[model samples]
Target chain A: MTSYVSDMRRRRLLAGGAAVAGLAACGLWATAARAQASLAMPQPDSAEADRIAAEFTGGAEPLAEGLALDLPALGDNPAAVPVRVHVTEPMTEASWCEEIILIADLNPKPLACRFRFTAATGSADVAVRLRLIQSMPIRAYARMNDGRLLAVRQEITVAAGGCGL
Target chain B: MARPPRIWISNETPAPGEVVRVRAQVVHVMESGFRVDAEGQPIPEDLLTGFTAMLDDALLMEWLPETAISQNPYIEFTFAARHSGRLRMVWSDGSGVADEAEREIRVG
Candidate 1:
C-alpha cells in the first residue's frame, strides 16, 4: 500500500509539471502573436509624425526649428516627466503662435496635448507633465497664425515605464 | 461637485511687463483605463481632459490634455503681467466634472 501511494504521488507531480510547461508555452506563443500585431501597427517614426502634422496643417511640412523643447535625457520617473515648450516666434496679433502640439512616440495615444494661445498671451511658453511608456522621442509642433509649422524632437530613456500595460 | 484645486504663482506681485510663472494642480486618480485591478478587472479611464487659464476676461493659455498626463495633473505657464486682475484656472475631466481656482495678482 505504501509503495502504491508513493507511485501515485509521483505521477501527480509529473502531471502538474507537464501542465505548467504547457501553460508557459501557450503564454509565450500568445506574447509572440501580440508582438507581431504591434509590428504591423504604425510605428514611432518621423513619417508617422509627419502624417500627424499634416493632419493639422493640411500637408504643410513643419520646419525642424523655431521650437525649443526641454526634456531630460533620462527620465527616472516615467509617471510625471516635466516638459517645457517655448515657441521662438513673437506672440503678436498678426504673427503669433496659434497652438502647440505635444506627441509621445511610444504612447498608445501619440497626441499628448494641444495648447492654444491667443494674441493676449504674453509669450508662447508652456510647462506641463507627461507620462512615457518607453524610451522614445517626444516631439513638439508649434503652429503659427500664418499657417507655418515649427517642430522639435527629443529622445528620452525611461528607467521605469508608464502609460503602458 | 469636484473638490477645489491648489494653485500657486511664482510671484503674486510683479512689476509691469514682468513675466510671472503660474502653476496649478488638482488631486485626481487620472486612471488611464489601461491598468487592471488586483482582481484583474480593467480600470475605467478617468483623466483631466481640459485646462484653461484666464486673466480677467482674456484667455491666457488653454490645454487639451491626455491620458499620458500623470495623476494629480499639474501645469505651468508664463505670461507678462500687464495689469492687476484675478487669474482664474479651470480643470475638466472626461465626465464633464470641473474644478476651478483663482488667484489675485497685482501688476505694479
Candidate 2:
C-alpha cells in the first residue's frame, strides 16, 4: 500500500511539471509573436515621412510659418520639455482647423505627439510635455478639415548633445 | 503608521471628451537599489514601481515603471472625460505595500 501511495504522489508531481512547462512555452511564443509584429512594422523612413508631408500638402510646397513653438533652444535636461504650439487660426469646425501633430524628425519615432479637437476648444492652442531624443527639428503639421496641411518647424539645441544611435 | 501621502491634479478642469492634463506628486522616501549605508552594506531596492488611475470604477491608465524613473516619480497622461466621476489613484512599491488616494472631478 505504501508503494502505491508513493507512485501516486510521483505521478501528480510529473503532471504539475508538465503543466508548468506548457505555460512557459505559451508565454515565450506570445513574446516572440509580439517582437515579430514590431519588427515587421518598419520605422517610417525619411523618404516616407517626406511623402506623407507632400501628399498632406496637396502639391503646395511646405514652408516655415511664423507660428510659435515653445521649447527651450538649449534644453538643459533632455528628460522633459514643456512644449506649446499655437497656430494663428480661428477655431471653427469649417474654418480650416483640424488636427495638430508634433513630429520629432530625428527621434526614433518621428511622430511624437498628435491632438484632435472640436470647435468647442475655441483656440488652436496645444500644450504638452514631450521627450526629445536629441537636438532636431521639431515639426508641427496642422491639417485642416479641408485637406490643406500647414507646416512649421523649429530647431532645438541640446546642451549635452542630441539623443543619437 | 506613516503619514498618508497627499496628491492633487494640476491642470484644466475635466469636461466630457476633453483631454485634460493631470500631474501628481507624492511625498515618500524612494530608496534606489544601489544605495549603501554608513557601514557600506548594500541597501535593498525598495521603491515605488507602479501606478494606476481609475475613473469611478473603470481603469483609465496603468503604468509599469522602470528604475530609470527618477526618485519621487512623476507621471502625466491625458484622458478623455466621459462624465462626472471620482478619480482614484493608487501607487505600489516593490515591497508590496500600496497607498491609494482619491479626488473628485466634475465632467459635464
Candidate 3:
C-alpha cells in the first residue's frame, strides 16, 4: 500500500513538470510570433512614406532640388522597374551625401533600399531595380553629411498584372 | 551550391579621377514570406540584404536593401577611381550567405 501511494505521488510530480515544460514552449512560440508580426510589411501609402521621410529629416521639409530621381514615366514591367538616384552636389569631406533612401509609394513596403556613402565615394549615384504594385509616385530622399535633407519625387504608371499578384 | 553571380563594369580601364559605372546581378527567387504554398505552408522570406564595394581595402559604397527589391536583383552605382586597384563587390542574403566578385582596373 505504501508503494502504491509513492507511485501516485511520483506520477503527479511528473505531470506537473510536463505542464511547466509545455507552458515554456508556448511562451517561446508566442515570442516568435510577435517578432515576426513586427517585421511584417505595412500597406503602401504615400502619406506613410512622407511621414517616414519627415521623421528622417527631423520634421523638416526636404529641399526638392540638388537630387535627381530617374524612372520611366510609363513602366512596362512593374516586376523589375529600373530606378536611378543621383545627387548633383559635390561629395567632399565637408559636404557629402550621407545616405540615399528610395521609396516606392505603392509597394506593399514603400521603403525599397538605402545606400550609404562616404566622402571616399566621391559621388552619390545609385541604380537599382524595384517591384511596383501599381501606378504611383516614387521618392528619393538624400541626407548630406552637413545634415541637410534633399528629396525628389517621380510618378510612374504601371500596367495591370505586376508584382504582388 | 548556388551559382556565382554575374558582375559588369562599364569602364575597366578608367582614367584617374574618372567615374566608372558598376553593375551586378544575382539570380534568386527573393521569396517575400508573404505567400502561402500549395500545401498551406508559409513561404519563408529570403532576400539579398546587403551589398558593398571595396577598392583595395578602401570602402567605397554600401547598400542595405529590403524585400521590395525584385527577384534576380540588379544594382548599379558609380564611383570615382583615384588609383588602380582591385574593386571587390560583395552581396549577402538574409541567411548570412555572401557571394563576391572582383575586377582589376587600371587608372593613370
Off by over 4 Å in 3: A1-44, B1-3
Over A1-165, each residue of candidate 1 has an lDDT whose tens digit, in order, gives 999999999998777776677866545445343311111122456566666767876777789989999998778888788899998765665678889989887676778788998887778898887877777889888888888898888898888643432
- Pick the DockQ winner: 1
TM-score of 3: 0.81
DockQ of each: 0.33, 0.03, 0.28
Per-model TM against the reference: 0.78, 0.45, 0.81
What's the iRMSD of model 3? 6.0
Which wins on lDDT, candidate 1 or candidate 3? Answer: 3
Q: Would candidate 1 be rated incorrect, acceptable, medium or high by CAPRI criteria?
A: acceptable
**Model 2: how far is A56 from its true place, Å?**
4.0
How far residue B30's Cα lies from its native spot in candidate 2, in Å, is: 20
Q: What residue pairs clash in candidate 1, if any at all? A: none
Residue A28's lDDT in candidate 2? 41
lDDT of 3 by residue, A1-165 (tens): 999999998997777776677866545445443212222344646787877787778898889899998888777887788999999976765678989999887666778899998877888999998877778888999999888899999898886754642
Query: Where is model 2 chain A poorest over a 10-residue stretch in terms of lDDT?
Result: A33-42
Q: Higher TM-score: candidate 1 or 3?
A: 3
